[model samples]
Target: MSILNPLFEAVAWVIMRIHAWLSVPFGASSGWAWGLSIVILVMLMRLVMVPLFVKQVRSQRKMQAHMPQLQELRKRYKGDKQRLNEETMKFYKENGINPLGGCLPLVAQLPVFWALFNVLRAISDWQPGTTPKYGLTIPVVQSAKDARIFGASLADKFLFPLPHQTLESRLVILAFVLVSAATTYLTMRQSQKRGMMQQGPVDPDNPAANMQKYMMYIAPFFALSGLYWQFGLVIYWVTTNVWTLGQQH
Candidate 1:
């Protein structure tokens, strides 16, 4: 009945396996190993989703191509909301396009995102000699608790600094926050710019355009919000954002 339990167990097993494999090369400093394992997890997830991403890109292009027709439909049915909806659906059907396809990638990622969160939370909350259904051993959990990247514990958050947080931890947290925000903003800005270039600049008063502009600005705030997440998750996020930027390019 609990989705989180199963997802957490699956993700934890994969993470622990990755950590174990990497530990051979990087022993006591397995914090970096764990951090990089998250990066690899992101890469693996993205790779698996590549086909869907392609569909999303193609859907956007098709939608952009039909923008003029859609506008015409809107004007033609300005007097009848029901007719407009019917016509829009008919048009999409005829074109072999699903307008909602653009959202598939984001929607699909939510479960995996939560799974990753649960896995990290489980590790952070682990008690001595206690092992969950996930394959992570007691020693693994202990090592994860002590895992540090650039002298900052992987479990520490920028907003909730550890009592003995050092200067290095603060600096590293700052760096991660800035990079995450910058990457998010840049990626969204680039997409907006491309859309503008293709669509000849969105009208400032257009409701849809206004919404897109708002999203462009508001979405980057997630990076600030992510400051509540563990530093390891932050590293995963930065890596994912960087990969997204490259993919978008």
Candidate 2:
């Protein structure tokens, strides 16, 4: 099976049930159900990843505590790049720290993220006059369908008043997109700040630190642009970022 298949099936099952439950009380036209489903999906994923997140945090703390020693080793081996790498790796092994542990939560989450992205994209593509499949039915087999959120159809609108064109949808989308981007940046800033506090000032000349700084700026742009692709997914990411920020604190 594909890496994302399990996550796709799990989210599809849960969200479909949620859609059904909401449909009973508010009817299918009530877009609130869809919104709630997305929120719940994000929550579930975060909960499942919590353990990995905790481990990552612990590993980061250990690495930070050893930063002084690591720096000395770097200076001692500066002229021998390969020896420096070997020494650094040996130190990390002896200390039982995986520097990459800081990224484990995110690495583990990619499959789930893609799964939900595809799921939401499918829902957005559902069309009118088509026999709508019920309860966890995947949307790819069909052609040219449109799904709506409130007055906005998922197919056309990048932000909101949706596809047919309304100022309201456009404003809503813009507002959410800005909020998402800002929140994401704030989250990254907080993480970097905390990491720096724990690890001390990274070597200005360090390639890894420079790469991280570059990502700090570049990532938000990619995240913000995603708002055009699917507003719901943007919300999910924003929510997750907020959660991560809170966890760090």
Candidate 3:
């Protein structure tokens, strides 16, 4: 009944298709098949998002380039707030500069992230004897539950692995969460440094500034999320963070 149901179905369908194609070559139970499917899915999504990212970057660079003119306008209209607002609107209209450009890509990305997480969660929640909703087949469910990378089931969580999973697999899950969390923190740090350099100072109470600060402190602790996230979802998070890091460079 929810509008998001379609998006969730689309995400599951894409993952299912990718896994089917990969399973043929790597074998249905092979972790490589599922892992590669997830990796490839991220690449595909990011590829589609590239144009939006490019546009955002271009818009930011353009704004930076025109800072001097904006400063001049501010100076000219210092005492006249109404005129300043009108002139700002005119400037934006003439220059085709969209103040909201930076938000479009981020906004577009949220649903994709959410849907992917849901699909992965559904698979991870499926154990050998359990069934998943969303029309996932028996073979699909079996393969996902059985798939193992480095002795660790993609369905395994770091904090509370199923009793059937081995200690070695538990260790691997721990490592995946730790590594993924570290990588994410590093990526965010890089972004924060870059943004600070580009945007200069801002008010302490600004939501964006506060968020940057909040995430900086919490980024390392993000590994705790592994308590709930499946190893497969960890793969998605780490891969996407790595992709974002590369883009920043």
Q: State each model's CA lDDT, in order.
A: 0.82, 0.68, 0.79
CA RMSD, predictions in order:
2.3, 4.1, 4.5
Error of 3 at 227 (Å): 3.6
TM-score for each prediction?
Answer: 0.89, 0.80, 0.74
Q: Give me the runs in candidate 2 sitting further than 4 Å from their true place.
A: 1-6, 23-27, 127-167, 200-203, 206-211
Extract clashing residue pairs from model 1.
none
Residue range with the least summed lDDT across 10 consecutive positions in model 2: 138-147
Of 2 and 3, which scores higher on lDDT? 3
Model 2 Cα displacement at 186 (Å)? 0.8
Top lDDT prediction, candidate number? 1
> What is the Cα-based lDDT of residue 93 in candidate 3?
86
12-53: candidate 2 lDDT, tens digit per residue: 687777666776765554556666666777788789899999
TM-score preference between candidates 1 and 2, better one: 1
Candidate 1 lDDT score relative to the true structure: 0.82
User: Candidate 1's residue-wise lDDT over 1-249, tens digit each?
Assistant: 475677777888788788888888988456678778888888888899899899999999999999888878887987898998999999999998798998887787778778887767777777776674466677777888788888887777777776777878878887898899999998888888988999997865455667888888898888887778778778878888898889989
- For candidate 1, the 10 contiguous residues with the lowest summed lDDT are 127-136
Please identify which of the two predictions, 1 or 2, would achieve the higher lDDT against the true structure: 1
